[model samples]
Target: MLRELEKAEQKWGGANKAIDQWLNNRRNLLVHYCRIAGLPPYENGNSLPSVDNVRSFCEMLVDYVSEGHFEVYNQVVSACEKHGQTSKAVAQQLLPKINDTTDAALDFNDKYTEAADDKVLMQLDSDLSRLGDAMETRFQLEDQLLEVLHTRHS
Candidate 1:
């Protein structure tokens, strides 16, 4: 995922301001996720992440998701409309999938954010795994949307 992010940054980093900033946030979000998920390099080898870490990750997660919907997705979709039918078709196809992932993300935020105590801690690992899958799906769909928009308009 980190490597994918680097490639995305290289591909679209200078393409648009909104996209660039969103990708940066994405990198931070991925790092926080890996830290919590205990996925190599960022792993603490611990069973569960600290409550503070979980709260921080949830905050970043929502910010990343919101920015994608409000800022980056809108820009890409607008560009798609300007290009042609094929681009529009790609965006339309991806939008629903992206929205599905958004629901998963918001659910994660809801579950973890209200965790004022460690009662949610028992299920944190499984929840993080599910959220990771959703995040990965979202990243792929978003990349596809950007690819269509940029390829057509470039």
Candidate 2:
């Protein structure tokens, strides 16, 4: 039983490590997206996108967001819950951050739908700012925990 517990703990540790890395990457992407978001919609090509074009691009972005922040994140959170780990609390706290990111993306979509002169950049900027803000908080929490653990274990 002791060995099993040790293994489980290690696995959870590994999972959280992965999540931290992924979240960092996601945050970076959001920053990058924001940098370009201020460009006008037509700023890309100065032409109106077809319905299909918009739908496909939006779908892809949503899928990407879900896969990273929801799908994989939820899997790790569930594992933590199953193991009765403190990760459960971490996961719960992080969930709202994910929602904030999602909301930003939705807001961008809403504005994109009605943007005049195809200036969709402002909406995209808003969305990225929201997502980046959430990511910053999540990463800070993770870093603080790591520092505490290091102090305790060292």
Candidate 3:
């Protein structure tokens, strides 16, 4: 996920102000995810992620998704309107799938925000895995939107 994000930045980092900010948000959210999931350099799985870490991840997760819906999607749609039908069609197709991912993210946030018991902690790894998959899908959809828009708008 992190590697994909870096590649995305390389490809579309400065294409526009909104995309630049959205991708930066993605970077921060993925870093927080890595820390909580104990992936890579954060892999100190001798213990569960600290409560503070989980809380922070949930906060970042919500904020990231909020920006996508409230800011990025609108910007993408507006850009597409100034272009061709293909871009408009692409945006229409992709945005709904992205919304599904948002639901998954919000579900994860709600589940873990107040989690403090062994039972809840026991689900963290699996939940993270599911959320990771959803996020990967969402990122691909978002990039497709950006690619289509940038091709025409740029």
Cα lDDT of model 1 by residue, 1-154, tens digit: 8898998999988988888899999999998898888888877765678899999999999999899889888888888888788888889999999999999889989988888877798898899888889999999999998888777797
Q: Which lDDT tens digits does candidate 2 get at residues 1-154?
A: 2232233344334545655455444444443443343333324443344444444445545655666665566555556566555656665766666566566566555655455543554344455566446545544544443333333332
Clash pairs detected, candidate 1? none
Deviation (Å) of 101 in candidate 3 = 0.8
The TM-scores, one per candidate, come to 0.95, 0.47, 0.95
lDDT of 3 by residue, 1-154 (tens): 8888888899888887888988998999998898888888889757888777888999999999999899988988988977878888889999989999998899999988988765787789999999999999999988888888777888
Give the range where candidate 2 is weakest over 10 consecutive residues by summed lDDT: 1-10
User: Candidate 2: what lDDT?
Assistant: 0.49
Winner of 1 and 2 under TM-score: 1
Better of 2 and 3 by lDDT: 3
The runs of at least 3 residues in candidate 1 whose Cα sits more than 4 Å from the true structure, single-residue gaps closed, are none
Residue 140 alpha-carbon offset, candidate 2, angstroms = 5.4
Better of 1 and 2 by lDDT: 1
| lDDT of model 3, residue 146 | 85
